[model samples]
Target: MKLLLVEDDSDYAATLSRALEAMGHDVVVARDGVAAIEFNDRDQFDAIILDRMLPQMDGTTLVERLRERGQTLPVLMLSALGQSIDKVDGLKAGADDYVVKPTSVGEIDARLHALVRARGWKGEGATTLRAGAILVNPGKHRAWYGDDALDLSNLEFKLLAELTRHAGSFVTRTMLLERVWGYDFEPATNIIEVQIRALRRKLTASGSPDPIVTKRGVGYMLEA
Candidate 1:
């Protein structure tokens, strides 16, 4: 995986960069929070490793700013401060995973995998979600459209949840495979198209116009 490692400590950054490289990850080292933010804008990375404390902008503030700008890449916050409250604060600021400093490479790698895997699984903690005329209760796996309850199966619910999460943006078939089906490898079947058709049928059963848009040769998008 390609990663952005942000740290003010040059020696530590070098050491960590080497270790990460040895582990087969491409690492870009950024010296401080300002550099980290700039690097993020200039490139795309699978994940970001941000130091909790940095010169100029702190880690938490940087992540919050990134989120405000609609940067959705997974972030793994690294900090020497290991308090529960500190971890909570980092997560609330949009860091996907928070780990105390002095962690093993194995742990960091594992957490990175977990963060990416959990990206579109909103059913974990989200109670309710709204996208245009659609309302979803993820906990109960129930949905509604303008007073009409939607009847959805397990895969259908997951698909709808992912589309609604990125309501105004295009959700590619590759994205659906990974996020909804949790498949790392693309399958040789048309399962996504099949399921999408099934979902559209149920969603429009009440005479509601189809909310999903298919961009040919591209992907799908949900209109809000």
Candidate 2:
């Protein structure tokens, strides 16, 4: 996997970069947030490690900018402050995970693996998943119907992958929220319904049959 390390501490960055490299990961180091953004715009990375304090641009600003540009790459924010509020602020700024400084290289590597796994959780181990004519490739993060590729958002891909994995089996909305969205508590908002509706529309846009079967008040299923 490729990683972008945006940190100002030269020694820490060098040590961490070496560790990741030894683990067979391609690591790109940026000394500051401005350089980080420039590198990010020019290169594609599997994950990003960011420091909260940076020269020219802060990590929060960088994260917000990346999100605004629709870049959904997994970001793990690193900070010296381990307070819950600090963590919350980082997440709210668009980081996928947060870790305090003085962390072990092993722990950082483990967290990186977890964040990347979670991002591609739906397609991690599976090669091909079929639900009627729809086919999904979890490894490649791609999906298709017959010969046509389906353009789906990150969330849509995860939702489709989950349903297709359990084809012919009922999957409740709560399960989707918990598994796909990583939500522990149910939100009052109908996010599942909204996303499903969007997915259905995209599926049928090419005149394909809707493989997703709504189970009314119970949940959803993909017919075999």
Writing each residue's lDDT as its tens digit, candidate 2 over 105-179 gives 888889989987887833212346666556677777887764467899999999999998898899998899988
Instruction: Give per-residue lDDT, candidate 1, residue 95.
Output: 94
How much RMSD separates candidate 2 from the native structure?
13.5
Error of 1 at 96 (Å): 0.9
Candidate 1's error at 198, in angstroms? 42
lDDT of 1 by residue, 4-107 (tens): 99999989899989988999999999988888866764555778999999999899998987665445678999999999999999999999999898999889
**Model 2 off-target regions past 4 Å?**
121-224
Superposed on all Cα atoms, model 1 deviates from the true structure by an RMSD in Å of 12.2
Position 182, candidate 2: lDDT: 98
